[model samples]
Structure formats: C-alpha cells, structure tokens
Target: MIIHVVAIIMELLKLINTFFESALFKKLINRKRSLNYIQFQRADHFLITLSKTCKQ
Candidate 1:
C-alpha cells in the first residue's frame, strides 16, 4: 500500500514537471519578459527625451 501511494505521488509530480516545461508555459514566460523589456525601453526613451528638452 505504501509503495502504491508513493508511485501515484511520483506520477503526479512528473505530470506537473512536464506542464512547467511545456511550450505554452515557455511562451507565456517569454511574453512576460518581452513586455517588461518594452516597458523599460519606453521609460528610458522618455527620460532621454525629457533631458534633451530640458537642456534646450
């Protein structure tokens, strides 16, 4: 009985692991990272423009 319970738990863990490593999950992560990068770039550009305008 103990062995059977352990085997079931192991199978559940494997399923969860595969889900995390799936392509859909990877796409979601990449999308989030790109969004953050775009936001950072926009903020940086705004600051640069603001500084240039101030100097002028």
Candidate 2:
C-alpha cells in the first residue's frame, strides 16, 4: 500500500514539473518579445534626436 501511494505521488510530481516548465517557457518568450520592442523604440528615439541635431 505504501509503494502504491509513492508511485501515485511521483506521477503527480512529474505532471506538475511539466506544467511549470511549459509556463516558464511561455513567460520567457513574452519577455524576449518585449525586450525587442523596447530596443526598437530606443532606436527610433535615437534617430529623432539625430535628426533634430542635424536640422539645428
């Protein structure tokens, strides 16, 4: 009876681990996309600064 309980617990742990990993992966991807967006915005701001300086 103890062995059976242990087996069930192990299976539950495995399922939980898989769920966490998938969620983590999705979060990382979203983070990377946001970083890219930030970088693009920064580049645009830099270009605007340069253009204004050149016109002055």
lDDT of 2 by residue, 1-56 (tens): 96686567556656754664697756865778777657755865775575466446
Show where candidate 1 strays beyond 4 Å: 31-56
In model 1, which residue pairs have backbone atoms overlapping below 3 Å? Answer: none
Against the true structure, candidate 2 reaches a TM-score of 0.42
Judge candidate 2 at residue 46 and give its lDDT. 72
C-alpha local distance difference test of each model: 0.66, 0.63
Best by TM-score: 1
Error of 2 at 46 (Å): 49
Candidate 1 clash figure, as a count: 0
Q: Give the per-residue lDDT digits (tens) of candidate 1, residues 1-56.
A: 96686567556656755775799867866878777657756865775575466446
- Judged by lDDT against the true structure, how good is candidate 1? 0.66
What is the TM-score of each predicted model, taking all chains together?
0.48, 0.42
